[model samples]
Target: MLISDLDCNTLKTHLSGQGLRFRTGPFSVSLRATIPAIARHIAKLYPHSETLDNDAFIDFHITTHQVAGLRRWLKPQVVFSFDGYKPFKPLPLAQAAAAFEWGLNWCIASSSHQYLIIHSAVVEKDGQAVILPGSPGSGKSTLCAALIHRGWRLFSDEMALLSAADGMIHSVPRPVSLKNQSIEIIKAFTQEPVWGERIEGTTKGDIEHMCAPDSSVRQPPTAIHAKYLVFPHYQSGCLTEITPLSKGRASMNLIENAFNFNILGHQGFEMVSDLVDSLECYDFTYPDLKQALDGIEQITSAKP
Candidate 1:
């Protein structure tokens, strides 16, 4: 069934009477009025994958009609459908659809490549993938946006799916989210950046997101041994500096940022450990984007 065959009208009826369609590399997601801003946030990362198709790598089949009824009749929670499978807990109607789309992408990546998906942002220069893994306030997305504008390729901005056996970072390019000042910073930096509607009142405060270009998404996923695992913190007035971090410390930090490290158990530990061993680890701090980009270029160029 092509994307056209899926009953768009039926899907719309189940949602609260609104619809917006978005595509990412091999995935297609349709959102209703109740959809959250985050879904729109990551859609920019994969531009080439935007074409509607019957054979999507992942398809989110969302219906709001069953959420309340399922919770009341079967269980006391919301229900979401993925290729017809039901998730019992209902997500906030606004974010639920997008969340399901992301979840489906996660399921596909993990199952197919033995990748442990970590909530992170990634940018590539040359053949090396630099992963930025952090919590919401960590300024990763902003930095990623800057780098991509300055010629770095975006691998992903939300989920960094790294292969367990090979240590190559898989590309799952999605939107790059920028909050408050970062939005303005990126807007001023790029001449024609693609952005969705600005969403307000999220836990991270007022927010807006930009989608990566289709060109970035269509490029083949590169298998670069990690050259740097730099943890970034954007502090106002602080000079850009890169400090060395031990492999063991980097491993611990990575585990904390991982989405399924515990699920992978000892193998997870070893995969991450091996990854750190093959790369340089650093704690990067910057008050300016240019300086940070310069530092990153220096690090990447110095690598053999």
Candidate 2:
């Protein structure tokens, strides 16, 4: 059953007690939390994600709870735990929900070595996938959020799980994270968006999350080969431009964005080599979201 099927009381009971196990793409996560905001966050963003039974094996077992001692009552803070080991310092209790999202990202990036993971946003269209690898403040997630809402299928907004065995991009579609001004920009772009509460005054400035479309969440976990490797540069008032990039440069960029490149060793090198060899690599610069979307559509639809 989906998380939305459960009432608030029941959902909170599960979260506070034996933990709430849910499926996010290929991974099974069990989250235990007493934070009230967490319930609201999951209920809204993960409404369509399926819940797992208690007996199921979870890939990441996490917990977010208020810190003990006097801090619980004075300036309350929360800590994130992975299988009983606390990896990060406590954050303000108000940021508990965001903490959960960040913590889960760490879990997948740090442990899921079976696939060559890259810090990129991926979207698919007409069976052809576009792999976007950019640094922070590069408008990566903003462009991703726009593409999925336009016509493309949302593969992922945070991580790209590239399979070593099949050389295909696996989908781990989750809520699209919007930070700072991008939050309001997207709210204006989409007609009606399903959004979590706008969290302000955090380390990443103001932050919010937009739910992935129900179709994206419900789609089967199938891997698709990538067709484009576009590194987007969002420059206000600049004319939209797409420049061809050499496969050698694209391979280097992929390695820089990769999470487990060194961990996978030679296998990761082969995967990067294969991807750059096959993908139409480019450097995409845009002034506005409309121009960005149009340029990408034109390039991806062109004959390779």
TM-score of each: 0.75, 0.97
lDDT per residue as tens, model 1, 22-101 = 45544456544333333333233333454443454435544333355655455433345554555445554444334444
C-alpha lDDT (0 to 100) for residue 77 of candidate 2: 94
Give the Å error, residue 119, model 2: 0.8
Residue 294 C-alpha lDDT in model 1: 80
C-alpha lDDT of residue 186 in model 1: 84
Model 2 residue 133 distance off true place after TM-score fit, in angstroms: 1.1
lDDT of 2: 0.91
What is the clash count of model 1? Answer: 10
* Model 2 C-alpha lDDT per residue in residues 1-304, reported as the tens digit of each score: 9998999999999999999999998999999998999999999999988999978999999999989999988989989999898878999998888899999999998899989999999999888899998789779999999998898889999999998888989999899999998987888898666999888888989899999888788875568989899999999999889999999998998899999999999889998999889989999999888898998898888775
**Cα lDDT, all candidates:** 0.66, 0.91
The lDDT of model 1 is 0.66
Looking at model 1, which ten-residue stretch has the lowest summed lDDT? 36-45
TM-score of 2: 0.97
Taking every candidate in turn, the Cα RMSD to the unseen true structure, in Å, is 5.6, 1.1
